[model samples]
Target: MSEDTNATDDRLRLLIERIERLEEEKKGIADDIRDVYMEAKAVGYDPKIMRQIVRLRKMKPDDRSEQDMLLDTYKNALGMA
Candidate 1:
């Protein structure tokens, strides 16, 4: 193959290898998170609600407040309040 073609192939291979490494690292981190959640559950904490709390914590306060208001409105509409 031409030198330019070889260089392009090498770059592509390096990019793919980097992505694969990152994917494996991501999977390991996910497993670690799952283990933490399991530990929380063993300690009598609800993992589902824990996940929701984490998600809400990641959101801006205003955005979370808006979501809470909408949820309350919907619940009231359904006579769940």
Candidate 2:
């Protein structure tokens, strides 16, 4: 193969390897999160609510407030508030 072709192949291989390594690391982190949630459940906390709290915490405060307001508005409209 030409030198340029060989260089491109090496670059592609390196990128794929990096992505594979990152995917493995991501799986490990997810496992750790699952373990933590299991521990929380064992301690009498609801894992579902814990997950919701984690998700809400990741959102910007204004976005979260907006969502809460919209949820309340929907509930009120449904007469379920």
Candidate 3:
């Protein structure tokens, strides 16, 4: 291969390796989060609700309030609120 081709190949390989490493790290972080939830469950905390709270906390406050309003509207429409 030409030098330019070789360089391009090397760069591509490095990018793939970085992505693979990041994927492994992501998996490990997910496992750690799962363990924390399990521990919370053992101590009597509700993991599902905790996950929901975590998700909500990650959202913008205005977006979350809008979602809450929509959910409440839907529930009230269904007479389930």
Candidate 4:
């Protein structure tokens, strides 16, 4: 209709296209990470534990220690320590 409307439509289309491209890239990266985990499993490594370790590594050391302490406290309370 108007030039302003056309501009707005073009900008919206560009934004959507950019997001779609980024989503595709994210999926590709996730697949690559999955492949690496599969390779680790094939070589006898435990993927579940590996994932936990990766998650822990991303946390601060103090936070990790606090979490471990809380886990131990809960375990001791349950008499499963």
Worst 10 residues of 3 by lDDT: 52-61
- Write down the lDDT of every candidate, Cα atoms only: 0.99, 0.98, 0.99, 1.00
Instruction: Between candidates 1 and 3, name the one with more favorable TM-score.
Output: 1
Which candidate number maximizes TM-score? 1
Clash pairs for candidate 3 = none
On a 0 to 1 TM-score scale, where does candidate 2 land against the true structure? Answer: 0.96
Query: Model 2, residue 61: displacement in angstroms?
Result: 1.3
Considering summed lDDT, which 10 consecutive residues are worst modelled in model 1? 48-57
Flag regions of model 3 displaced more than 4 Å.
Answer: none
Count: clashes, candidate 4: 0
lDDT of 3 by residue, 1-81 (tens): 899999999999999999999999999999999999999999999999999999999999999999999999999999998
Candidate number with the higher lDDT (1 or 2):
1
Runs in model 4 deviating more than 4 A are none
TM-scores of all candidate predictions against the true structure: 0.97, 0.96, 0.95, 0.95
As for TM-score, the candidate ahead, 2 or 3, is 2
RMSD of each: 0.6, 0.7, 0.8, 0.8
| Cα RMSD, model 2 | 0.7
Candidate 4's displacement at residue 51, Å, is 0.4
The residue-by-residue lDDT of candidate 2 on 1-81, one tens digit each, is 999999999999999999999999999999999999999999999999988999999999999999999999999999999
